[model samples]
Target: MKKMSTDNKLISLLRQSYGTSNPQEAATFLSSAIGRVLKMEKEARRAHITEALKGVDLRRDAGGGMNSKPKTVYKDTKATQEKLAKLEATLQEMKAKYHALLNDGPQTAEENTRLKNRIAELQKSIENQKSQHFQELALLRQHSSNVANASELAALQQQLEDFQELSTQLSDECEQHKTRLKTLEATLEDKTAQVARLKKVMAEVAAGDEANETNVHQLELELANAQEALAVARKQNEEYNDKLLATLDSHLAANHEIDELNAKLVAALDFGQVFADEADHWKNAHDQKYADYEELQRRAEQTQTEVQSKYVDEHQRYKAASRKIDSIIEEKDGLHRQITHVRSLLKFEEQKSSDLTRQLSAARLEMTSMTDDLAQEKRVSELYAKNIRELHDQLALLKNRPVLPDWLFSGSMASGICFGLLFSFSADVAPAQRVLLGVCSGAVAFTVARIITKKNHQ
Candidate 1:
């Protein structure tokens, strides 16, 4: 409860220090504060690890102390490693998928747009072909209706039938060709993309393999060094143990001497023979031996902790290398699948290309046949347009003339209106009055010209 209250107080204090009061502002403040705190925490953890490592050296120098239970430590380390491996595998898989997506996403989108445009063009071409086919069928029908002889009519009908059959067959083939081309193009594109992706992935796999090799070499070196250190520590501890045994023997011998002194005193000849100062010296030596034993025990414990820490550090490094290798292997497997898919697409594209070439040849032949027909039609259309223009001119010359001249009928109203404006300006009249006078004069002049033209027509 106290911890929670203290955390809340800290948050409030941080928010104030960052000059934030609103909830959103506070959130930003909290984020930065937490980030800084995490950085500090990480630094603190690193410091602790270093300190623990240093303590190990200290313990080794002091001599072998009792180690923590090896079996229990091993079990814990194994479990931690297992969890780390699983987590790293998951993380690596996610990274591979994300990288693949980033690489291919834009390319896939661009290919889709290109395919859409091709489809639209295909649709437009098909529509135009359909309209042209209908027009040609109408023309053939008209020609058939005009046939006079039964034999000729039968021949024409047969020809029309053949042409229709050919056209229908050609159209069907064209449609099929288009459909096949679309399928082939799509497959080809798919294969090409897959091949490219696989190639890239394989390269990455190679690079990853090199990285794994390096990591493995590093781990091996570290392991060998650790083994050597352990051996040296063991030898030191053994020597220290031997020295402790020798100290025990000396302490025992001193006690034995004190016992002899006591026995002599008890026998009642030895007030002169017994030494009180020598007894005091033996007691102090026993005390000193016990203190040394305790110190040795403490040093042994520190050395054990140091060895455990070293093992953990090496284990972490090994786990990281294992994770990288696992990721590389997974990518290689994915690349194999992509390569197979690409090969299949390549075959489809080859077949599609062959079909497309045949279709192109047929289109070129049809275009050649249509060329003369279009030119002949254009010439006939031009002849009809020229004749229509001559007929129009003839009719225009044969028509009756107008009663008045072009300028008299067309220009009189314009001239009178313009002169009336000039007269109004010379008289210097008010704007409204001048406008009225100008309109009246122009109206009078137009009425007189119209009367004269009507009389001339009569």
Candidate 2:
């Protein structure tokens, strides 16, 4: 009875499973139930056989006693009959169920045909789904690749911006350098002008020195001639004085001898008056020459003083300008060193930027490759799903069972559901396609749900 109850429970389970009208589900359920029943039956049979063997052994040990022989034989026969009857009944029940299931042959055939059609349609749909999934994967990969490319592009653009900024700064620096150079050149020109002026001054000083030398020489010659003239005048005056003295002595002797000498004395007084006037004129001329020589010497001293002052001023200015020039040269040298340092920094920056660009490029390439692999995997998964569906259909046909009903097939619904799942699961999709799929699926589900609700309300 317990075995019968268990069989009934299994049958009930089979019926319930079949009622769901899903062939694969039914197959799976039925196969499991069948396996369980077979196992249980085998275990029961094994136990029963073992008991029968033990009974035979006991009968043989009783050594042909009538009671032992009849009891053991009857028990063994009865157990065999019961087991056979139970097996036969179970077989008959299974046959009746199989017959009942086959009674709707035309309907089952039609359902099967429809199921095959639906399966084919579903397979095609699934294939399309797979293709769409592949495309979506490809689109996702493309988006990922594009994102990587955009990142690289942004980096490159940033580098370019940096380069441009550096270039602008360099240009500004160059302008400043040019201005500085011009200023230095102007300073050099001023220095040159100053040098030229100093040279002119020195030339004037030289000319003045030459003039002073000539004046000194001329003055020396004039002094010598004046001294000679003074000596000759003194000599002439001495000789004349000597001759007058002699004439006075002779006149004195003649006066003593002759008292009539008064007329001759008056004539000697007139000649002495003419000689005194000439001597006074010569003394005034000699004093005027001495004053002229003193005036020339004073003028020469003033000229020398003026020349000395000019030389001192010029020397100071030249020294100051030279210092300034040295400072400018030092500044220029410092600027050159700064430029060299800046150039080295720029070179290092350029190398770093180049390395960054290369790394970005490599990363983008890797992303593209990964995306392609993902797309391929999606395609393979789709193919596998299609194959499973085909095999399922073939298996249903082989089992001589009705395929699932159209209402339970769920091809279109499953496709839409899968699309939704895929859309939700993955974030990589083309904008246009994603939007279109979302809208279409949403509309379909909404329409179906609304129709069902309206029908239910009615």
> Residue 344 lDDT in model 2?
57
TM-score, candidate 2, is: 0.25
Model 2, 368-417: lDDT tens per residue?
Answer: 55555545555555565565555556444444532222332234445565
The local lDDT score (0 to 100) that residue 311 gets in candidate 1 is: 56
Between which residue pairs do clashes occur in model 2? none
In angstroms, how far off is 22's CA in candidate 2?
A: 72
TM-score of each: 0.31, 0.25
Global fold similarity of model 1 (TM-score): 0.31
Q: Highest lDDT among the candidates is held by which one?
A: 1
Least accurate stretch of 10 residues (summed lDDT) in model 1? 65-74
* Per-candidate local distance difference test: 0.56, 0.53
* Distance from true location, Cα of 27 in model 2, Å: 61
Q: List clash counts for every candidate, in order.
A: 5, 0
Tens-digit lDDT string for candidate 1 (248-346): 575566557656655644553455446656555655665665576566656656655665565566566556656655665566566556556655665
Clashes of 2: 0
